[model samples]
Target: MSRRPITEYAVLSDCRSAALVSSDGSVDWLCFPHFDSPAIFGRLLGDEAGYWSIRPDGETSRTRRYAGPTMVLETTYRTRNGMVTVTDGLIMGAGNRGHDLGAGAPGALVRRIHCTEGAVRVAVIFAPRPEYGLIEPVLREVPGGLLIRGGA
Candidate 1:
């Protein structure tokens, strides 16, 4: 994974934690559970520092913004074949509202993407290097999603 300019990154926060998403739909830096926690996706620090990427396979033009008044980011990628919108958010507490928005944080990140027009081949990469790339965890597949183990 390569590092993008800080200006090209979007900040996604759930009050308790934050993640930085690059212009190419890659999460280059993410520290969960707490603000001071070790990075779960730390590519910004080094080449092998792990990352998660989701994007259109070929050349694409990108645009992104924070959805409404929340910290959730909506990034749109337009390829020659089609356009897709990717929404990313560091999930906050259930039912939490203003003044108590992050009262019961869950420390989870959610990324959702959908085609807005036409169709394009998608590219996806998931690599988790916890603790600033010091821990190479084992990834297992379960019924609903993937599981990460063998890390402290």
Candidate 2:
């Protein structure tokens, strides 16, 4: 895929860290743990860097907007078969403080998808190269999702 204009990306944040997700449903930039940390997904700089994408199986017309005044993002895709909405955000803890300050905060990236009409096939790919493509992390399938670990 060709590089998209930077203006085409949407911001998702939790007051501690942020992610830049493109209109096509690809998270091109993400700094984890803290705002100053290195990016795990840096495809915005190079193709080999890394990326996480969840999108429809084929072409789709898309419209996106921040869910409200917050950093939560809602992107709706209309495919030939059906329509789906994907909500992305860096999880926030209670009291609305930085995620790290909350007792239950896990510093997690959340992506919620819902199918509103018809039926559509979705695909998800997560390829993380931590420390800005310096270290390729190991991914192990867990009970719920894959666990990523590497680097220091």
Candidate 3:
């Protein structure tokens, strides 16, 4: 993947937490639960930092934008073989507009990708390092994705 400027990253949030996703579909930075909370992904700082990425296996061109006025991000990737779309967002709890993530509001990050055209191979890498890359989280495969834990 080609390196992109920090300005090319898109901001996604539920008003509780924020994630910076690169144009190439890499989640380079994310602060969970709250803006000041420990980071789960911080590759934006350096290669040794953590990151989670999902992208087309081969070469691809992409376009992205927020869905309406919401924090939901939609990225579409078009490859020689086909096209795919990825949607990312942080889900807010009932009755919560997420005005304050520091208020102990609960939420979850969600990523969904779907093939829209022909066929395309997809790639996914999930690495979680907490505490600003000071901790390498243990990962276990769950029925759907993974369970990650580290540091206090």
Give model 3's TM-score versus the native structure.
Answer: 0.88
Q: Model 2, clash count?
A: 0
Local accuracy of candidate 3 as per-residue lDDT tens digits, 43-91: 8777567888999998889999899988899999999999999999888
Against the true structure, what is each candidate's TM-score?
A: 0.87, 0.87, 0.88
lDDT of 2 by residue, 35-150 (tens): 89889998998977899999999899999988868888999999999999999988865565643364556667888899999999999988898888888898899776677776
C-alpha RMSD (angstroms) for model 2 = 2.6
Pairs with steric clashes in candidate 1: none
What local lDDT score does residue 1 receive in model 2, on the 0 to 100 scale?
34
Q: Model 1 over residues 56-132: C-alpha lDDT tens digits?
A: 99898988888889898999999998899999998876787567765655557888999999998999998888888
- Give the local distance difference test score of model 2: 0.86
Error of 3 at 19 (Å): 0.4
Tell how far residue 60 is off in model 2, in angstroms: 0.9
Q: What RMSD, rounded to one decimal, does every model reach? A: 2.3, 2.6, 2.6
Worst 10 residues of 1 by lDDT: 98-107
Q: What does candidate 1 score in Cα RMSD to the true structure? A: 2.3
Model 3: lDDT to the true structure: 0.84
Give me the displacement of residue 85 in model 1, in angstroms.
Answer: 0.5
